[model samples]
Target: YGPRTERSKLPRVKVAEPATPEQIQETRRARAKAKTETPTLKIEHKVPAAERRCTVCGRTDLTTIGSGKSSFVNEYVSSQLVREEHVQEVLRCPCGSCVITAPGAPKVVGKGQYGASFLAHLAVAKCADHLPIYRIEKELARKGSPVARSTMNELLHRCATIVEPISKRLLDLICTRDVVLADETRLPMRNVPKGKSKTGFVWTFGAPDELGGVDIAYQFANSRSGATPRKLLEGTSGILLVDGYSGYNDIEKVSSRRRAACYAHVRRYFFDSLKTAPIAQEALDLVTALYRVEHEAKEARFDESSHL
Candidate 1:
């Protein structure tokens, strides 16, 4: 036999109703704010005089009315590489004894040809979009600016060096928070030996505020050892919400932080045990009830004290 198969009914999920008039207007205002938040160069289009005339009456006279109807159209401007020529005007005294020149243009890297904007774009493409250097080079070539892959790699390293301080500052800010959540995931790294790879762990730390805003930081380590969390969260004291990992326990013992186990992990263990242990089903039912209560509290906008 290949395998056992069974058919069952799927659970139904509730669909949200359409927004009220007030909610719709609020959404429109928020969208307008988002649309205008960016710095944009606007180009206005005006109706030609001939086209503005009344077509049915064939009259050129038109009455000015209230502000004309308006709509917003989003457009993407393609990236183009431009050669910026900086001309510094040289000034000299009539006696020719002293001379001065305009200041030179600033660059992302000292004496480097690439501008700060270009370097920032490259960095965002590589890090945020996960584009390889070779792929980025091909894209630049298609845009009429063919740059060497090696040169792009060097520039990326230089950009990373410039951004390191800002990243450290963000990490420091996250550490100062009262509550933090952490997790780790495995990442494969190419090893020195040909056709070989090493498994590494990428630990993530997140600090979430009451307003649903979050700041996250990541640390990459070769091994998922207890010392990794200890080093990454050094000097940080708070409530850590994480899965039941032994490594975190070691950190909790050494630091002032307290470890709070994830309820989802407990639910998962009970769910898995249902296969062999029938009593696990009762635990699952209790967990479901707890979640339902939590959902009701959220829907009613209950605060911590109100829920208590």
Candidate 2:
């Protein structure tokens, strides 16, 4: 294992003729199961409505008085966003200090619509549903409230500005956490300063800490280079779980910093192999071993805290 010696190419072994019908059926079933078996976020229970009561006074009495539902119909876009409109006025004040008024719907985007709730729905639509403002405006016009696309864009920027402080705080907590998972995904952003039409990269850092569980931070950079991760993780010391990218190697340059390879990345190679060269069963088996280890670890509920 010192100096690698080149090996002579072995004669390619012919795989038995293409799988039979039965074998193909079995492969189909296994692939379907493997695709469906990927782990996902598990939310156990919803927080009780009673739990939202005021902490100062034990008043479990709260009721919604006026409620209305609005339908925003757009014939142009093949999407319909139906939302409930609510007007709730709380009856009791725990300490008699303030009367809590929670509006039913948002009216910010649409003139006749609910303000905060509307803004919130629009924000969620933009962020989660990935809908552009012009489309949303057209959708709103069908419902009677005509919202301008430019206004929607400004609203989003305002919302982002409002939440940026919270994002910075959470990001700070994440970067200072015990262990962090670092990765980057491509983001399409205009780099006008560089006078180029190329897209920017969004460096993502997911860190877990006892204080705030997991915090995800994203930064848009002009390029995907080692310097980005190096700068983000500079002066940080922890095990970084990342895809085996050379960019992460720069972390080791900082004394005492460690890196762990993502099993998902290793599994992806097997998937690619299955698609490109299905006959490479030996390589497939090696990848399968990696999945087996991950499965066993998950079943054991392996606590990464031990490494702390």
Best by lDDT: 1
Tens digits of per-residue lDDT for model 2, 1-308: 15534222232443224546886787788887885676444334434886857678876665644453433332343334455657588765788887867665545344544356666888899988999788889888997668788878888887788788988787777766668888877777655799767767878888866653667887767888888878767787778889977877878786356888876676556555655676655654565555555555554445654321
* TM-score of candidate 2 relative to the true fold: 0.54
- Candidate 1 lDDT over residue span 1-308, tens digit each: 15434222222333334556886787788888988996677566777876988889988888867666666777888887899999999999999799999998987888899999888888999988999999989988999999999988999999878988988787777766888888988888899878799999988888975666799888788898878778767777888889988878787666788888887788888777777896777776676667666876665446666843
In candidate 2, which residue pairs get closer than 3 Å at backbone N, Cα or C atoms, i.e. clash?
86-104, 106-114, 106-115, 106-117, 106-118, 107-113, 107-114, 107-115, 108-115
My TM-score estimates for the predictions, one after another, are: 0.77, 0.54
Q: What is the C-alpha lDDT of each candidate?
A: 0.79, 0.68
Model 1, TM vs. native: 0.77
* lDDT, residue 65, candidate 2: 44
Of candidate 2, the 10-residue stretch with the lowest lDDT total is 6-15
